[model samples]
Target: MTIAWASFTPWLALSGGVLIGLSATLLWLGMGRIAGISGIAGSLFSLKAASGDRAWRWLFLIGLIAGAFIVHLLTGGLFEVRSGYPIWLLVGGALLVGIGTRMGSGCTSGHGVCGLARLSMRGLVATLTFMGTAFVTVFVIRHLLGFGGSA
Candidate 1:
């Protein structure tokens, strides 16, 4: 494998990472809630949840979408996201991710970032499992199945 140095934007990546961390930190400090996408989204589907309980979750999701739009506006369509997978494949992948997050109790933002920051053992284990699974899956798909470049 070769590095695509021309396409790499370390500064932008670093800034995004910093922003994510800061947002997670602020959410924890201000709201005392984990920045877990699954948990936040799932709460809205619960019939037992009060309207007040659902408000923040709705806002958080809305903010996420709005933030992407704001970024697109600010950058003048600079960010280009490309995918070779068909719509069915993309949908399937999303479904798998949702299942995985449900099974794992939290998503990457929760376990990998906030959980680890709090030094929770479960977070460490979850993060390891997530990373290991990703590594193995990528290796199998790319090398074993010979589906590297086409993807």
Candidate 2:
């Protein structure tokens, strides 16, 4: 394998990581909530949740999407994540993720970030399980099934 030095950016990557960590920390510290996309999305329609909280969550989610759009516009080039799948399939997959997040009680951000940071045993188990499953899926797709359609 060959690495392109011009495209390699350790400092920028580190800065992005630091920004994400800081954002998660601030969210948790200020809101007393885990910075989990799944939970935040779910809370939008949660009648039991306070409307004021939901309003903030909605704005945050919108800003996340808007930020990505803005970056795509400002940057000349961005990662072209090609998925050789139909829009319907993508929508279906997203719905499945939503359901899974609800059933799991928390998504990766919640478990991987807040849970693990707090040294919760369940978080460790969940994170390991998620990682293991992801590894197995990739292996199966790339090697066993030879599904090189797209990533």
Candidate 3:
């Protein structure tokens, strides 16, 4: 187990975590809503919701995309933006994530961050399952299957 110390930026990681936490906190306090990306996105398609409900979701998604662009501009091509995965794998992974988020009733931002902060048992269980599954998947793929160096 070796740390990639050359690429490690603890300060940046901490600041990003703090920013996410703060934004989640603010969203909760201001709107009495959890800042779960999947929930917010899924709700946009709800026929039961009021017409006015979709605006915030759209804005939130737009802001997320725009923020990535902003970061790219600020970093000035220093970042490695591409994942080395094949397109089919990326698409499959995305579909799986969408399905998982739907089945779990929340994504990582929702369950791991907001739900845990609110002390919900569902959040704890979901987060544990997510982390455990990720650990097992990585172990199987990298150690057992010997695909570690490919990606």
What tens digits encode model 3's per-residue C-alpha lDDT throughout 1-151?
7788999989988988898998898888988888999999878755566778888888888988898799879989656666565676568778989889988899899999988988999999999999999899878877887764543
User: Which tens-of-lDDT digit does each residue in 1-151 have in candidate 1?
Assistant: 7888998999999999999999898888998988988878866765668888888999999999999899899989876677674675568778999888877888888899888989999999999998998899888876887664544
lDDT of 2 by residue, 1-151 (tens): 4578988989979987677778789888987877888788887866778876778898879988987788788985478778675675468657877877788867788888778988989888888887888788767866787665533
RMSD score of candidate 3 (Å)? 2.1
List ranges where model 3 is wrong by over 4 Å.
45-48, 148-151
Off by over 4 Å in 2: 1-9, 45-48, 81-83, 86-92, 148-151
Find the 10 residues in a row with the least total lDDT in model 2: 142-151
Write down the RMSD of all candidates, one decimal each.
2.1, 3.1, 2.1
Candidate achieving the largest TM-score: 3
The local distance difference test score of each candidate is: 0.85, 0.78, 0.85
Select the stronger candidate by TM-score from 1 and 3. Answer: 3
